[model samples]
Target chain A: MDLLTNILGAIATIILAFVVGMSYGGIVRKITARVHNRLGPPWYQNFIDAYKLFGKTTAIHHGWMQIMGPAFLMVSSVVTLMFVPVLNNGGWFTNLNFKGDLIFLLYLMVFGPLGMALGAGQTGNPNSAIGVTRGLSQMVGFEIPWVMALVALMIQFNTTTITGLMDVQQMSGTWLMFSSPFAFIAAVLAMLGMFRYSPFDIVGAPTELASGPVSENGGKFLFTMMSSGSIFSFVKLTLYVDLFMGGADNLIILLIKTFSIYMIPVLYGIVSPRYRTEQAIRFFWGWPLFFGILAILYAAIF
Target chain B: MINDKNSQKIVDIIQNWARKHSIWVLAYGTGCGAIEIPPTMTSRYDAERLGVRGAATPRQADVLLVTGYLTTKTLKRVIRVYEQMQDPKFVIGFGSCTINGGMYYDSYNTIKLLDKYLPVDVYINGCMPRPEAVLAGFGKLQEIIAEGRANGAQKYKDNLEWYKANQKKIIPSLLTTDYNW
Candidate 1:
């Protein structure tokens, strides 16, 4: 009975995350349109788009791996969400949140892109190959500082579990953003690349590479990628909130915290021009890397 | 292969509704009328409000907007792009050029009739259709989609032989694959 209940709880959490993620994506579109001085589609436009994709009668596939790509991406996003505590306290929203799962979360996050890369490679499109290469290279560049920041936090709080870190913040009445400003700054900068917006969106340079890795993906395949992308965006924002902004105790607080973090990348994307792959690599390794080191040093000292 | 007519009709209604609301237009510009696209997409017209956003690749696109006249050379590429697009795709022939070759009517290189080469779901007849006319064409497309009258993809598939024969007359060295699938 307990096992069944737990499974149901997990499913509920996944559904909630998917719905909220897509909604946030829609809101972002509306916000972007307003910024451009144009009225956008309805906030539920993404829902209609996804539904239409599923309803599409015509679909083409390259191979088994191509089919597995979006599946892997969706799984990774949901799995990462599962490890993070939804509410600051505990309830139906409280995911598995097992001890030492931070490392697992990090690995699962990267697994999505690696799976996508394998799929993109088989498409026989030169654009897909180029996009995958840039994506993977950018991954390497950003992961260094991102991991460093995570490591610093883990060391400072003496906990590898996300819930443990949240507890430390709550008990001390100080968010990680305030306590470890260096790590916060490093992580935020790394997030610019992670979000894959402008400046670091070399992977999916639509103008240059025709939407990059998913160049050959269409209909249901593209739909799956889109949903997984939204879910992953939510997971990333939630993780940032839990680590830096202090985990929210309720739904409203969670939305407030996550949406603000979400804006950092979305707003930045509107104004900035894209960077080349090499330029992006150098950017991450420069100031962000320096900030990561400073964060580690600060953690070690105090 | 939905055996039940009523169930199939119901499915189509829902599909049509979703399809009409989310027409992802491929950003492939084949001619001079491409100049008007930027304004339509931007704040002045904002076609995105109607869910007619530009797609980067043929794979993900729902609507292929063939702007202005298609030379035989460009026609081959357009046909290839059309074939590459997934099912339930659409073609919108923009400007009088696509209908009757407009200013290029006397040109030896331009194809006189686009429908002979590929199935066109919508045709916006104008010298160079203004952005408003382009949007109106899209609105017509949405109506056709909602009424489930847009069967151009299926038409192309069913009449592939005739289409290919017509295509070969112009581009004798057809470089695209058979596209039988």
Candidate 2:
């Protein structure tokens, strides 16, 4: 029974990952279109693309580098999956909950982009080189505020396991969104920056950089990236939802909270112009990061 | 022996031929021309009724719509993307850029004619073409697909170097001091 349960869970996880990714992608596309006052592609548009890419031929830059790209993508998303809890209980991998700490899960988040950069760097393509450089730039810009926000949250909750944070809301009947609003807002902004949606899309701007690091990856590798990116986004969003709006016995409220948060950035993405790397750096380093750190100190005192 | 096998093959062919009309488009919204492609595709103009919807990747898209001017830099990447798509693909040359360079006619970076570099079916003309014109082009391409002459993917594979030479007419480097992707 345990073995059968594991098989079913793994299969279910993969399917959810696929749908979650497509849903995340759909929302991004639809919201950007709405922001522009235009009708975007339908919600399942991302799923269609994934299906389409899988059917197409794969282009391996150096052939060998293909292994690293998908492996890292799969690994990083899998790590996120392990840390994330479902239904107020430890998710499928309870062992991860036992052995891994908050630091481990956070470290896993850093692995993905680095792996992508290394894989692209080996391709020796100039456009991809520029893309990897911008990804690094984006990482450098957002990391400070993201860290500050996490630090603040840690001080407020006084625990590291993501479950503890979620459980805090469940036990206290107050979501962090209302609890440490500043840290919550900062965390939201930092995550959006990490996603590099609009303006901050300096690294992979179609008009400027042209798909950036993923430019060279085609066929199976592109498929893997799409699937992993889609799934991981869902994982990330779920983590956010779990962090902010727990204890909703009614699923509608939870769905509404998740969808609304996703919509906020998506709407902004539509009407916005891609930011020059300099603008992004300024946005991250200036007031946002400063205020985020201030929130941590405030949380510590209170 | 030939009659029995041929008739069975013909039956299989008819079923497959009926499937191509629902051609998904992978619209590479490259430039200004992409403006018109989607409007022609949505409920207002209703491309779904015509069996064409914009797809995110080149793989699922049977029709690759090059909506506007292909910058020399973009064309190289375009070729790479085009090559990645599966067989039985159709390249819809939409707008003046894909047809004859549109507003970028003299721009050193733009490809004056996409056909010189890539095989194009159904040239739909307009500097910034209307949604109706895009649908008309889609209709024309679908007709070609139905007739089985629109599959350009196989031609590309058969003579890769011959086609790469077709793009040699483009001196993309002349447009920039140092060519950058």
Candidate 3:
């Protein structure tokens, strides 16, 4: 009975993530349009785009790996969501959080991109290959700071579990952003690359690489990629909230925190010019890496 | 079963509605009329307000906008792009040039009639249609999609032989490989 209930809860959480993430995406588009002094599509534009992609009647796939690309991404997003605690007070929202899942969560996050890379490799397009290489390189650059921040928190609190970290935050009455300021800064900086915005969006340079890794994907394949992206964005935001914002006690608060965290990248993307691939790698390794090392040192000393 | 069918119909209606609004156009510019597209997409007209955005590749694009006259060389490439697009796709023949070759009617390289080679869902007839006319063309396409009248993909498939023959008449070298769509 408990297992059945957990499964149902997980499904519900995935659905909620999809809806909220897509809505956030639509809102981001609107905000971007306004920034450009233009009237954008409605806040529900992403939902419409996703639905339309699914509605496309014909699609061409290169092979079996092409079919698995979006599936792997979806699995990774859902699995990451399952491991993260959504609310400060655990219930249905904390569907599948388990002790020491933080390391597993980190690996799962990379798995989707690896899968996508393999699929893109099969497309026989030089652009896809170039995009995948840039994406993987950017991933390596960002993960260093991200992992260091997580490790700093883990060492400081003596807990490798996300819920355990959240619980500590709740008891202290101070969010990690205040307590471990260096780690928070490093994480937020790393997130700019994680969100794949300008300066770090060398992989999917739409005009240059023709939307990069998913260049060959269309119809249902593109739809799957789109939804997976939304869900993954939500999962990443939720992870950040759990780590820094003390996690939300309810859905409204959760949305507020997640949306605010999401804007760090969106707003940053708007103003900045895209960096070349090597320049992006160097950017991540520079200040963000410095901050990550400082965070670890701060945790160790204090 | 009846309930299932009704729900499926509802899904179809919703899907059609969404597809009608979000038209991702291929970023391929074929002729001089391509000059008008940039303004339509930018802040002045902002085609994105109507959910019309530029797509990077033919695979992801929903509409192929062939602007102005297609020279024999360009038509070969355009046809290949058209074939590469997924089902439920559209072709917009922009300007009087695409409609009837415009000033290039006497030119041996320019194709006089575009519909002879590809199924065009909409045509904006102007020497060079303004961005407003381009937006109106998109608006008309949305209406066609909503009414389930955008059957150019199917028409292309049904009349592939004729399209191929007309295409072969111009490009005797046959530069395109069989995409096998």
Query: Alpha carbon lDDT of residue A117, candidate 3?
Result: 95
Error of 2 at B157 (Å): 3.7
The C-alpha stretches of model 2 lying farther than 4 A from their native spots are: A90-95, A247-254, B1-88, B93-118, B125-131, B139-149, B158-181
- lDDT by residue (B1-181, candidate 1, tens digit) is 6779998888888889999999999855778889999999999999999998989999888999998888888887898798888888999998888888898889999998889988999999887789999999999999999998999988988988898899999999996464546
lDDT of 3 at A167: 90
Worst 10 residues of 3 chain B by lDDT: B172-181
lDDT of 3 by residue, A159-183 (tens): 9999889999989999999999999
- Every candidate's fraction of true contacts kept comes to 0.92, 0.03, 0.95
Better of 2 and 3 by DockQ: 3
Local lDDT at A136 for model 3: 97
Clashing pairs in 1: none
DockQ of 1: 0.82
State in Å the error of residue B161, model 3.
1.5
Angstrom error at residue B147, model 2: 8.2
Question: Could you give candidate 1's fraction of true interface contacts?
Answer: 0.92
| After superposition, candidate 3 runs with Cα above 4 Å error | B2-12, B175-181
lDDT for residue A219 in candidate 2, whole number 0-100:
54
- Highest-DockQ candidate: 3
Residue A228, model 1: lDDT of 90
lDDT by residue for model 3 (B141-174), tens: 9998887888998898888778888888888887
Model 1, residue A296: distance off in Å is 0.5
